[model samples]
Target: MFGLIGHSTSFEEARAKARSLGFDEFADGDLDMWCSAPPQLVEHVEVTSRTGKVIKGAYIDSVFVPEMLRRFKTAKRKVLKAMELVQRSGIDITALGGFTSIIFEDLNLLREERISAVQLDWQRFTTGNTHTAWVICQQVERNAPKLGIDLARAKVAVVGASGDIGSAVCRWLQRTGVGELLLVARRPQPLVALQESLGEGRILPLEEALPEADVVVWVASLPQSLTIDTDSLKRPCLMIDGGYPKNLDTKAAAAGIHVLKGGIVEFWQDIGWQMMELAEMAVPERQMFACFAEAMLLDFEDIHTNFSWGRNNINLAAMDLIGEASLRHGFKSLGLEPASSSSPALSIA
Candidate 1:
């Protein structure tokens, strides 16, 4: 079984949980955690490729913003508690999901005396961002044509190109073929290093690159809203909103830009019953975000290694491997709706 740590973006989303916990009220940074045994699987789901792959798990919600995670004490407490909960629930591997992975990126609880005393293997914990990048690339490729932008000859701009997701997207775009890639981020050195390492893209500030881009992907970190002169983008540009809080300005969509949020994938089968309940959301049956799917796929493959970790670690080979596995397991890039052909979403397999 695989486990995941998640978080809510608003206090309203967790208000009931807080009340159930006997609290009079809930604040923005409040945390919640729970475990699910042998997750709910639909009957027909057994006929799919993921057939015998049973996933039971636990999740934690550490409300939004990095300010709450600035102190090491908070991260350590939440990380350790979440780990203990998953371990005690009989989960074999626990994947850090959402901001939980970002806030606790380099934290090693196994090295701490408290966890060392328990003798749990830290290797069982993996960051789900690897497969996320893979799916993002697939989504881009699948949707590019529908958006009327040909990636092979389009000027692509990646916001937050220095971040884990943005960097990986850049690497994949470089390999997949693009007319030009504009790397954008606040940090210059890492952007320069990444540009030099990739040896393909040109490093430019977000402002300078925005007007020249035909395809814009927003993956910047929190508090840094993606501020671009959308009117200056090449005519009929493709904009992908791939950030956690959704960086794209929705107004741009009304102005005729094609925008698709990151982490969304189309599943060929109905395995969403239990997964939806676990997430506590009313997601559509066939659609799932790739980050959550990563843990489920890893559990199905029975590969317990720390597959993806650290910043800027996602590469072409790993992305391809995971992409292939996801395809084999009934996950496709067929967009959110079957009428996706008429929509901005791409129908990829």
Candidate 2:
């Protein structure tokens, strides 16, 4: 069976969800109490593909909240414990969603094994980034024209261009004939390397690139202190917020500036799961994060392996493979109307 490892966006949301799930203890627990809680397997999912293939899966709540981010040791342990649970459950393949994936990649957790006598098997886990990049690219290609922006002539800027998803997005856009590619990130050396590898994109500061971009793909975390100047943004500009805590709408709201949720996909039919409800998706039954869907796609295809892992390892071929699988199994980029209409208050898997 496949699996998905996830967490709540905040402690309050986690408490509410815990109560809904009948975890009364968790419902009353404080952040510190939550940090010490064990991961929970909250859902057993059955999804049927358009091709009539059926797959079984489970959702493992890491019991992690964004508030734990400052507590590095707690954050690391939460992710590792969830991974350990997945491994012990005998799940064939699992996707690390949201910050779970980020922690795994950032901490280089692959070197870890034998979590309290359970040997961790790296092959059973996938970062699910390949499909996410593909979905984001598809969103850009499909949505830009609706706003009357021709991608071939539009300058696209990728925030967090040096990240795993961001770099993959940059690689894909390079082949799309965009007018120009602008790379933005916090660090310079990686940005320089990415620019050198692409041999095309202009590396620029986020402040400078925002005004010039016709389309902006954000895969980075927005600093809490940062405030976007909507007045400075181009009218009719498209912003694809692919980052966690997806709050760009609140920050960049303005006339003629369209913000679309990036890295999301819609299934043709209900997957008979309620996990998305916890994620607070507008259409919980059908809408889901592309990263989570990747695990489902892999399970449906019976490709029980880590299809996506490691940093900067995502290539055009991998994206194309997963993209094709995604469509064949009846998953596509969610439409602009639903994407724009729904504003999930918290970031989640």
Candidate 3:
């Protein structure tokens, strides 16, 4: 009964990651309502770890702020219903998917007839997911030659450079030797700070940055008031949008920029028996959401779930740890799809 709170690709992918890490079986029709319950919930509640127990007994799902709060409310009710059904069917463990884990902060308030309230905090889950996205993207770049993408000389623009995801990407690009990295954001100070921290490169506002970028990652965590129009972006760059309402406006994407929905790919180790049907199915990195990577990474060490990364703060070391864990878990990036270097890179000309 994991509630996929938002409609964006990242949220759904995160939801899938939750399924991979927490849920055991994935039947043909997930909505069928006839699949057998997980063995842990039915007969082996305490055979393993406390953290897994905490997550298993919880029904995780995604939920954003004011924009989709209503959706969260609705999803909350549906989950409550699912818990009730599960209780009647002799199952006690609740379903907590990755997105649901985001909203876990408010579990104390969630009250059902026979079950404990759900817990979540979107801010934490989102930041964790975004951090994982940054780590995952970099790892993908490390193996980009296999994917026919290059990062050594990539002209990249990070839309939310001032924030956690954007800044992390900037640092990652620099570390990986991206030839020209352009960071864009509303406030230049944070971007400049990141630039200063990196001890090199350019950090400019969005309007001045995108024209010549080879790969542009728009992972801005924006408010409802913000929407990126075509006039604000340049042409033909690979646009990776990780925003909720979507940072790449539909028309702006028409400017010939190939837009990709950033996502995560999680590997399930302990649940191999449950996934025997798809034994060889290693979830492509694109299949999981960034937050799920964050959770899975944290889950591995049995650490408490928290907002470990975001725009408010920059923790490069923590980001590195998450990146290392993903590589160990068999996840890789989609690589940088290069545009012709001969074309003018920036609009300043």
Candidate 4:
């Protein structure tokens, strides 16, 4: 069986979800109560692939909210505890989703495996980044043509290009032979290293890259003070928002610009799980974050190991491996209908 470790987007949402799930104590209590709350295995899931292979899984809510980020120790404890619970459950493989994965990677939780005498088996968990990168890249490849943007002749900019998912997307785009690739990130050192590795990308500031991009792949969180000027973007620009809290549509709303939700995939058959509803997926029954699907894929193929982990470890070959499995299992990139005279700016597929 596979497992998914996840969390709510905010404190209020977390409280409301807890209440709905009959966790009245968690709902009635304050943020402090949440910090002390243990992870809960709230749902059981069964998915059948196109090849008729059925896999069973469970969803373990970390009971973590974004507010816990202010308390570093609390945040670390929440993630570690959830991981420990999954390991103790004897799950064949598991995926860390949302902030659970972020906290795991950011805090380097690998070294904190010994939690109260229980050792975390790293092989049983996956960060799920490989499938995410693959889904985002597939969105770019499949949707750009519908808008009349040929990737080989277009200038593409990847915000947060030095991150695990960002770097993997860059490698795939580079291999596909984009006309011009602009690599943007906060740190110069990593950005420089990425550019040197690619041997063919332009490392530029976000301000300079935005206006010139025909396609923008965002995998980083924008600063609270930052505001995008949608008017300055290219006439037929395509922006793929691959980050958390996916609010780019509100930030960059304008005519002739399309913002596609990235890192999302749609399954042909309903998986019959409520976890996606809590995640606010458009089609709760059929759609999910690509990261979660990675665990399902791993379980289906019997490739039980940490498929994706650590920083800068995602490569083109790994992306291809997962991408092929995704298609074979009847998973495809979430579709988007481009805007036209009669259609709205963007419509989900």
How do the residues 1-349 of candidate 4 rate in per-residue lDDT, one tens digit apiece? 9999999999999999999999999899998888999999999999999999999999999989998987889999999898889988889899999888888888888889698779889999999999999999999998899888999999999999999999999999999989899999999999999999999899899889999999999999866678998878997888999998688887888888888989988887777888889888777778889999999999999999999999989989899999999999989787575222222335322
Count steric clashes of candidate 3. 27
What is the TM-score (0 to 1) of candidate 1?
Answer: 0.80
lDDT, candidate 1, 1-349, per-residue tens: 6666665454454445445444443422334322211121111222235454555544444333244456566666656666655555566666776666766566745455344345556666777777878877776787777667788898889888988888999989988898899998988999889888889788887678877888877787535543456667667776677776654554354455666666666565555344344344324455555776777677778877677777788877888888888987777653323423323432111
RMSD of every prediction: 5.4, 2.9, 10.4, 2.6
Task: Identify the runs in model 2 with alpha carbons over 4 angstroms from their true place.
Answer: 339-349
Look at candidate 2 and give me any clashing residue pairs: none
Worst 10 residues of 3 by lDDT: 38-47
> For model 2, where is the 10-residue window of minimal lDDT?
340-349
lDDT of 4 at 280: 87
Could you tell me the TM-score of candidate 3? 0.53
Which model, 3 or 4, shows the larger TM-score?
A: 4
Superior candidate under TM-score, 2 versus 3? 2
User: Ranking under lDDT, best-scoring first?
Assistant: 4, 2, 1, 3
Task: Evaluate model 4: give its TM-score.
Answer: 0.96
Instruction: Score every model by TM-score.
Output: 0.80, 0.96, 0.53, 0.96
**In model 4, what is the error at residue 201, expressed in angstroms?**
0.6
Q: List ranges where model 4 is wrong by over 4 Å.
A: 338-349
lDDT of 3 by residue, 128-163 (tens): 654455654654364333334466866777777766
> How accurate locally, in lDDT, is each candidate?
0.64, 0.89, 0.46, 0.90
